[model samples]
Target: MIEVENLTKKYGDARGINDVTFTVEKGEVLGFLGPNGAGKTTTMRILTCFMPATSGKAKIAGFDVFEDSLEVRKRIGYLPESVPLYTDMQVPVYLEFVAGLKGVDRRDVKRRVSHVMDDCALNAVSKKYIGELSKGYRQRVGLAQALINDPEVLILDEPTIGLDPRQIIEIRSLIKSLGGRRTVILSTHILPEVSMICQRVVIINEGRLVAVDTPQNLTAQLQRSQQILIRVGGPEKEVLSEVGKINGVSRVSVKENGADNINAYLIELKKDMVDAGKDIPPVIVRKNWSLHEMRPVGMSLEDIFIKLVTEEKIN
Candidate 1:
């Protein structure tokens, strides 16, 4: 549904997007991740045909974004990072205007507007002026207009930004519902949003493509060490020495509670050495150490994102 090849966009001496290349398959929800000023908006603009790339090529729904931009525009639904709306117009009114602007069939305007209003949960505020609506409702109105033409590919830039929790949940669910049939490219800085709604994530840092994979795969790739948090009631020095002596335990460090009666530690193991986990737990138990808690450290999307972004900065 989307294809980009060696895409480059530069403004004077500054880089907007640099040598970026990736694709999004039909029926896939691709989450675009990057820090602020990371060229995400620049890339989205190029994909939506709002602006042409300085070099390289992009196609949406089989239509070239530059050469065949008209067809691409007809096939793509774009909700920009900062949604543009006619604040004085009512929900249905604005949608009706956009439908005509997008050249939807004259007779189908009413039907299309109604369908999008219903789909985006804007029916209750259908007659309300956009300026009178809350940010969440205003966002819905923006989303409703994007769907008025029923474009095949949806390019959403921070669709859930500034929404309340309930509204965020509603929008997230709405994006999930649209994924398979819509070929969604969701852009945002929120990691959980990517993890929850995207089937796959494309992480970009400093205008460069850093990684692209399923959420599970990205997290797994960043988890190089099998880390565990352990708390034991014993002399802190003795505990550290014993943990260091454990076979396959490559590194051990006390993370907390050094002055207190109990010591807490974070253990890093040699690659693929977690199978020796059994030996450590057993040794602690048999050595008269009182175990309070032992839990596997969880990897979050934020952790993976930070690690990737930091690595990019270093290189």
Candidate 2:
């Protein structure tokens, strides 16, 4: 439901985003992932028409963001990084005012405001002032206001940042529930959150679109070598040497131990071949080394991100 092509933005030679291009399908939740200063927020701002790009084109819900900026604005629900809230106004009052500004029919304003308040779980605090509420509640109020117009697309930038653990999960669940009807493009550095909620990811770095794929695919390609950690009660030297000699086993790395006892080591294998958990235990048993503990070290998304983006920098 969103398309950006060669969208470039610059501020007097200070780069914002360059050569950025991507699209989000209808019903797709696209996770915009990158480190800070990676131009994620910059892209969202351009899409919302909060600011125009220096060059290139973008369309939201099929209308050009610049040419049909008003139509695009009407179709989008944007929860920017810092939700601009009228701290003095009470919840229902603030939303009602927003509804009028958005040109909601006077007869339908109450119903519309009530509906979003319910959806965002703000019904209980509809009488509370925005400034009096905690950060979590204020964010909920921001989201409530964003939904006041019932826009078809939701563009949330770091929506859950600075929230406590409890607040984070609650907001995440709320965002997930808002799916099916609204296409979402969420920009967050929280990798796990992206994997959990997004159908696909658009990873960017240094104003460039680096990679776009399913989280599973990205993690798998970078998982070239697998490693296992093991602790045994018997001869560490012999067990380490023997595992290194096995077919498909590439290297052996051991942890430092006291002079009299050494019981732990890391075994590396060709990632595609050896099932380290199934193979290594038997080897230690055959060598008469009491295998106290053995566990495979699965590759993580963080590992893949660091490897890919860091390599991009060097090249």
Top candidate on TM-score is 1
lDDT of each: 0.89, 0.86
lDDT of 1 by residue, 125-160 (tens): 877888899988888887887788988999899999
Alpha-carbon lDDT of model 1: 0.89
- Which pairs of residues collide in candidate 2? none
TM-score of 1: 0.94
TM-scores for all predictions: 0.94, 0.89
Q: Which residue runs does candidate 2 get wrong by more than 4 Å?
A: 103-105, 256-262, 271-278
The residue-by-residue lDDT of candidate 2 on 1-315, one tens digit each, is 899999999988888999999888887888999999999999999999999999989999999999999999988888899888989999999999999887788999999998988887897787788999988888988888888888889999999998999989988988888777789999999989988988888889888899899888887666777777877766666777888777878888786453445467777888677664576778877867666677877677777778779988999
How many angstroms is residue 49 displaced in model 2 relative to the true structure, after the best TM-score fit? 1.2
Residue pairs clashing in model 1 are none
The alpha-carbon deviation from the true structure for residue 60 of candidate 1, after best TM-score superposition, in angstroms, is 1.4
